[model samples]
Every structure is written in C-alpha cells, then in structure tokens.
Target: MMIAIGYMLSWRKWFDEQSSRLIAKLVTQIALPAYMISTITHDFTAKRLLSTLPDLRFPVLSMLILFALAAVLIRVMQIKEEHRGLFESMFLNSNTVFIGLPVNMALFGNQSLPYVLVYYMANTTIFWTLGVWLIQRDGTHKQAFSLKTTLEKIFSPPLLGFIVGVLLVLFHIQLPQFILTDCSYIGGLTIPLSMFFIGIAIQRAGIQNVSLNRDSLGVLSGRFIFAPLLMTLLVLPMPVPILMKQVFILQSAMPVMTNAPVVAKLYHADEQYAAIMVTETTLLSLAVIPLLMMFVKSGFIT
Candidate 1:
C-alpha cells in the first residue's frame, strides 16, 4: 500500500525529484533518528538485554556469515565491480526496522519488541559500516578507501540515535515522559515518508526501467529464500527461546532494506537499480511472508 501510494502520488506529480530529495533528507537524517531513539529507548533495558543478548548474537553471527556467502556468490557470478556492492548489500541486508517491527508486532505482539531491537542493532551496524562502503565504492566516482571518511559516514544520525538509546539502557536512565512522546511523534513519520520517497523515485525512474534480469532474480531469491534458510539453520541450534529464534528467522526473511535507494542516491551508486530492487522485493514479500508462515506451521523452518 505504501509503494502504491508513492507510485500514484508520483504519477500525479505531487512529488517530483526535488521534493523527493528533501523528503529523503528528512527521513534519513531526522525522522529515522528520532524513530530509532524512540523505539530503542522504549523497548531496550539492561535486564531484557541480559536475557536476549545471547540469542541476539545468533542473528548477528548469521548475518556476518551471510555476508561472506554473498561475497563468494557475487564473485562466482562475476557481477561487475560497479554493481557488486549494491548486490552484496541487497543480498545480505533485510528491512529489519520498517517491515520487521510491525510484522513481528502483529505476529508476536508487544512482547517481541526487544527481539526486534536485537535484529535492528545487527542490521543497523552492518548497514552503515559495510553497506555504506559498498555504495561509496560502487558509486559514480570510485576512490581509494579512507578509514576516516568511512567512519564519518558510518556514524550517521540514525546510528547515533541508536547509540544514545543504548547508553540510556546501559545506564538505566529514564527521560521525562513528554520527551519520549515528542520523539515518538516525530519518529513515526519515518516509514510513511520513506515509502513516499520510493513512490516518487518509481515515478521518476519509470517502472519499465525495473527489469527482471539475472542480477534481479539472484537478488530477489537471495533475500526471500536463501538468506532466511541459512539464518534458520544457524538459529535453530541456539539456546534462546523458540520465539526469539522465530523472530531472527522472520527478520532475516524480510524484504531488502527500504533505504537501499536512498543510500545509493546519497553515495551516487546506481540508484535506479537500487530503487527497482527495493520495490520489487517489497511487493513480493506480501506473498513470501504468508508462505514463510506456512513453513513455520509445518515445522519446516524450526
């Protein structure tokens, strides 16, 4: 529905390229950070972390392993260097924040939030570090790697919001209720705004530009199928509760991160391709989610 809304709005000219850029800035820099702070502070606690941390490590480790696998697969497929980063980032990362939270909430209710945060930490950490590097390296102009510049990009507003939220949890500090309320109100816009940006981008790029080629097929399959399978195997043996295991698998199965095109544009990579991947995988997830639930019910995923 969000993508549909974005597409319709763009078709109607309510949001063009310039307006879309502004929306991207607000979502990534302001709204996303605010949302991160609100969710992390509200959901995370040291006691909760103590219990969930061990299980959380499973998801992080699984993600790292998947990253390695993605690198190998990209090499085997001989994907061009320019497109490699986008492929790797798309293949390994999932939409943990935007899609994972709500899906988990619906499937497991409010009690599952801490587990979602666990996946969020892993996803955010990887996304900014490795994900940003991929975008920059594959960007329009390639340059020698610099640790300092990379660090600057990685420590973005969203990550900072996460860090501050973690600090609050670590120190057991509680801000006044009114402040949390304000953050909540501001952060709530991230998803809708993000979808709107995608909508505008789809219009600008034209849906016909999105092709179902070899790379696209590889990406869609990797995100919706193989990634989850690999994570489920890694998660099943963990000592955590069953629900935690399920959350990790479900989060892994989510569509490609919605911010892929936004980050691609920010770093000057193939934003058109990135936008296509995001749009296609997200639309396909509506079907994939239900199929995954069936697997879980049949005890195939566990």
Candidate 2:
C-alpha cells in the first residue's frame, strides 16, 4: 500500500504526459508481452495447465454473481441510464493483474503462480468479452469485439509468458540458462513499471471534481465490501481446494482495476465516476484486505 501511494506521490513531479504515454506504450505493447513469454516458458505443462482450469471455476462464477449484483444495485439506486454504465463497469473489472498478482505471489509463493496465471487468463477473457459487452450495451452504436483488442489483451506479454511456460512444462523442455536468466531480468520489471504507470495515470487524471458523498460512498461500499462479502459466502461453502479458495477470496477482495476508466471512456460511461470508484476502492482496500485475510485465517469468514 505504501508502495502504491509513493508511486502516486512521485508521479506528481516525475511523471509527465510524454512519459505517461511512453509507459503506456511499453506496458501495453512491449513489457506485457515480455512478461507473458517468460511466465509461459517457465510454468506451462499439460497436466499443470489442465489442473489450473478447475481453479478458475470459483473465480469466474464469483465474477458473474458480483456483476449481477452490481447491475441490480445500479437499478435499485435509480442511477440514470447514462450513469448506469459506470455502475455496471465497477462490478466486473477487479484488480487481477497489478495488485492481485503481486499480493498472491507474496502470500502463496511460486507454487501459486500457476493459479495466478489461470486467474488472469480467465480475467482478461471475461474483461474483453463480457465486460466490453456490458459497458457498451447502451452506446449509440454497439461496439463489436475487435480481434485486435482481443488478441492484444489475450497475448499481452504476461499472458504469453504463462502460455509458453505451460507449453514448455508440458513438453518437459528445458530452458537454456542464459534464456532463463534474461527472462528473469526482463520479467522483474512488470510489477514496478505497471504500478508506476498506474500512479502516473492517476496523477494525470487529477483528483478534482470527484463526487465523494453518499452516492460515491455507495459505489465504494459495493466494490470493496459488499461484493467480497457475497463472494466469501458463496466460495466458502464450495468444496474447492484451500489454495484455490484463498485465491478466489483474495482476488474478489481486490480493488477496482485501473482499466475501468479506460473501458468506461470507450463506452461513453461516466468516466469520472469510474475513476472515483477505482480511486476509492484502491485506497480503502489497504485496510479491508488485511482484515479480511485475518478473518479467513481464523475461519471466521469461512
């Protein structure tokens, strides 16, 4: 949390528009692909890759359930149709990549990496397909799924790494020492670079004209508290493995993804509201997540 906050603060002075653009290019085009290739090269195996699919069952289900709830909440609040897009956008896009990945690694170590890979793959698939469909449902002209966008999201560097890693593992292929070392060096940049980009993006989108009163509070509560609580109740009763359970719970507990606003903009949703939702949830999750983790550890939540 401190790290994320520090990046935000530093961005005020250090991150300019040009640098932000460059970072976006790097992340979207270059670094992400590199990260995917490395991860796929290292972990891809026929059996392990197949095993990872079952782990996805709960997370994907939870996402659908939460998305429905979010839609209902938006309607219940009587949010204008124009604003409903923002509300619906909040439900589906969890922080699976930047925040979730690092925390999962810290909590579960290398063994859990495969789970992270599958979760993210499922996440990107859902985000580009279902998520895009939802936000653009009310647009003047509906946006069809673009192959370019789909491929970019699916083959993003980190995801490609997962795919390659699984393939290698499946074939029992050994990576040369030099390739392994170089991949490690390049893959190491993903977290910091992504986080810094997020910080810079937030900096560029200054926190002015944000609505933080009751309506805003409701959005934050829905994303940070209500959604996770609902997921916990559903997930804890399931007979999935403990690691899978923890991963589902933790990912559910994540703040809104940074990409929420981008999607909102694309669909002509309330981008300001989306930004507020992302900011509020990200700020509040620092407290909420650790406490929730404690509850899970004590078997209180389960």
Candidate 3:
C-alpha cells in the first residue's frame, strides 16, 4: 500500500526531480543510522547478547556459502561488468527486517523472534560491510581500492551506528531516556521513506519497462529457489532446535534486501534495475509463501 502511494505520487509529478535522491539520502544517512542504534540498544539486552552470538554463526555461515555460489553464478551467467557487484550482493543478502521479521512473527509466533533477530544481526552487519563494498563497484566512480576508501565505505553511517549501539550494550552504557525516545522517533521514518523510494523508482521505470529478462530471472531464482534450498541443506543437518532452523530457512527465502536499491541509488549504480528486481521478487514472494508454509507444516525441514 505504501509502495503504491509512492508510485502514485511520482506519477502525478507531486515531487521534484531530486526527490528520489533526497529520499535515499534521508534514509541511509539519517533514518537508518538512528534506526540501527535504537533497534540494537533496545532489542538486545546485556545478558542475552552474548548468548545470541553463538546463534549468529549460523547466518554468517549461510551468507558465506551464498556468497561463494553467487561468485560462481556471476562468471557462469556472464552478468554485465557493472552489475556483477550488485548481483552478488542481492543474490546473497535477504530483507530480514522489513519483510522477514513480520512474516516470521505471523507464521511462527513470538517464539521465533529471537532467532529472527539473530539472522537480522548477521544480515545487517554483512550488508553494510561487504554488501556495500560490492555496490560501490557497480557505481560510475572508478574505485582504486585504497585502505582509506575501503574503510570509509565499510564503516558507513549505518554500520557506525550499529557499532555504537553494540558497544553501548556490551559496555553496559545507557543513554538517557529522552535521547532513546528521540532516536526511536527519527529512526521510525526508515520504512515509509523506503516504500516511497520503491514507488518512485517503479513510477519512473514505468510498468512498460518492467520485464523478466535473464538478469531478472536469475535474481528471482536466487531469492526464491537457490536461497532457501541452500539454507535447507545447511540447517537440516544441524542439531539446533526445529524453530531456529525453520526461522533461518524462511528468512533465507525473504525478498531482496530493501537496502539494495537504496545503496545502488546512493552509489549511482543501476537503481532502476535494483528497483525492478525488488518489485518483482516482492510480488513473487507473496505467492511463494503459501507453498513455503506447507513445507514447514509438513515437517519438511524437521
């Protein structure tokens, strides 16, 4: 619904030419950093924080395997030189928060929340670091690869905010109540603004422009097919609780990272391509989900 609204507003010329760029800036620079801080500070407490780290290994490992596969696919598919980076990023990363969180809560109930966050933590960290690095390559700017530039890209605002929040939690540092409230209020804008960005991208791309080409089909297969199948193979053999395995598998099948388009736009990469994939996969995920539930219900994972 929010996405539709963004598209409508864009079609009506309700926004200026710079609207999408500004929206991306607002999200990545302001809203996302604050969101990273607030969510980490509030969601994970001191005691369980360490306990959760062990579970974190699962997602981290899952991403590493996915990354290897994406590398192979990039060479095999002969993805365009510019898009290779973004392709690898999208193929590996999942939208574990916006879509994954609520979906897990709905399907598996609150008991799965902890496992969901574990996946979110790993996904968020990698996306900001390695994922952002990959997107930079797809941009117009020629990356010479210096230690300085690498650090700057890796420790972007959102990642810094995540680091700050983690340090605060680990050291038992507490911000005043009002400050926490302030972060919460500003950070809350991340979702609506992102939906608007997507809508605007779709509007600009036009329904006529959207099509399932080789690139689009590869991304779809990565998200809906390869992703979950890989997760199933990895987690199926583990001794973890069934709920945690289920959450990990479902989270793996989530839509492309919402940040894919955001980071792509920020770096002057193919934002339109990113936006189209997002829309395509998001719509397909809705249909694919019923079959996914059937798998879970049928004890396929167990």
Best by lDDT: 3
Residues 107-166, model 3: lDDT tens digits: 886466567767877887788778888998899865554667556755667667766877
Error of 1 at 237 (Å): 2.3
Candidate 3 stretches with Cα past 4 Å from truth are 71-86, 95-142, 239-247, 257-275, 289-302
When superposed on Cα atoms, how far off is each prediction in RMSD? 3.3, 2.9, 4.1
Return the candidate ranking by TM-score, descending: 2, 1, 3
lDDT ranking, best first: 3, 1, 2
- Return the TM-score for candidate 3, rounded to 2 decimals: 0.74
What TM-score fits each model? Answer: 0.81, 0.85, 0.74
Give lDDT per model, in order: 0.77, 0.69, 0.79
Task: Name the lDDT of candidate 1.
Answer: 0.77
Clashing pairs in 1: 6-199
For model 3, state the Cα shift of residue 26 in Å: 2.8
> Candidate 2 — what's its lDDT?
0.69
| lDDT by residue (tens digit), candidate 2, 155-197 | 7766666666666777778878788777777767766766776
> Against the true structure, whose TM-score is highest?
2
Residue 136 C-alpha lDDT in model 1: 76
